[model samples]
Target: MTVHFHEASQSVTTADAAYAGLDERHAVQSGPGTFKVYRALGKRIFDIVCVLMALPAVLPVVLIMMILVATDGGNPFYSQMRVGRHGKSYRMWKLRSMVQDADAKLKDYLESNPEAKREWDHSQKLKRDPRITRVGRFLRKCSLDELPQLWNVLRGDMSLVGPRPMMIEQRDLYPGRDYYALRPGITGLWQVSSRNESSFADRARYDALYNRELSFFTDLRLIVATVGVVCRATGH
Candidate 1:
């Protein structure tokens, strides 16, 4: 799939109009024709098999991170409501990568920092976020914080490759229809590509492109690319 990168100034309305001609029915199905067995069944099977094989290596790291994160006297795991296929919501889990009162800190910090607030509004992330702890920074860089999402993949609330899960509150901010038609992914086009560099709105374009070009080989390629991203520690 050729992912188009738009200027960061692009508005939600503009992004939506860009894909206004996309067929919603076709977006839900993998590629063109009906009876695409992979989208219906094989994709889920792939998620399960990959997760099962990965758990052997992933579980130990998760366990270790849990203890390390909890050493600060807070819950080691964090979960938040995320929009899933068909606009359904589910609790997406992750290893805690922030302080116990991250929300409160963020609210107060943003109010005092106009520049930071602008960044958050545009990308929904903070490069120099004060909420991240010392160990948390390392985990975020290595992307170990996202390993817990392997459970979400097994639960069928997510895919190994698809659009990144949008926050429940971001439902209004998102302008593309493709994300609602498919399960969210732990790593996808945006995540493996622009990631932290792009505005949150750019996700719509990547999600739509991914859906329009959905295929077994596409998922496989994205999964392999994810491994390289993780090895390079490109997160955060």
Candidate 2:
């Protein structure tokens, strides 16, 4: 479960080959590898069961966050198109963690700030983004902004553990096909690892690695790690 950062040239070729090899292995190991069953069926079932169990406690927090977010005078929940399994597009839900005009603000901010633009171009994230509201900052810090994605899990648009869903526009930026082979997740190897420290391009490599090591145990370990990340408030 180690995440290695290879040079861009090597990483892309490695990820592409890894995915091709993984598909062949899954086909051949279908019968002997119970993990195959977990990937195909058990994973979805596990997502549903885990979401069901978590909802009771999570709902109240979601409601509270919604009210707090709405105080800024806009929708509390935000949904954006994200690339999902098989290159399909789905609306990924999240509690709004930015101002109502976040996109517009981001565009202006990037255009005015050369350094910030470069950072955004590299990672598609801003460490000191001006678009985030106070409450939104806290929610994102605690990883609570993503709580609404449980519904996406129940709807089969996402899994409890898989690659972090990429924006539709980011499809070409992804270097491997592994992301399209499985559902996007609320949290995954990338999210549990040193995510903030990694470049956006590095995501495809992590996604490929996760696919290569896909198993019930791997998913379980990632889920547990996600809890630790939330507890540590490491999320941006």
Best by lDDT: 2
> Residue 203: error of model 2 in Å?
0.9
Per-candidate TM-scores read: 0.85, 0.86
Please, what is the whole-model Cα lDDT of each candidate in the order they appear? 0.78, 0.79
Q: Estimate the lDDT of model 2.
A: 0.79
| lDDT for each residue of candidate 2 in 8-55, tens digit (9 for 90 to 100) | 333344444333455455556454368777987988888999999999
Which residues of candidate 1, in runs, are more than 4 Å off? 1-35
lDDT of 1 by residue, 1-236 (tens): 11222334334444344334445644664455432777788889989999999998999999999999999887899999999999999999998989999999999999999999998988788889999988888898788998998999999999888888889888888877889889998877776556665665578877877787566766776677667767766567
Report lDDT (Cα) of residue 5, candidate 1: 28
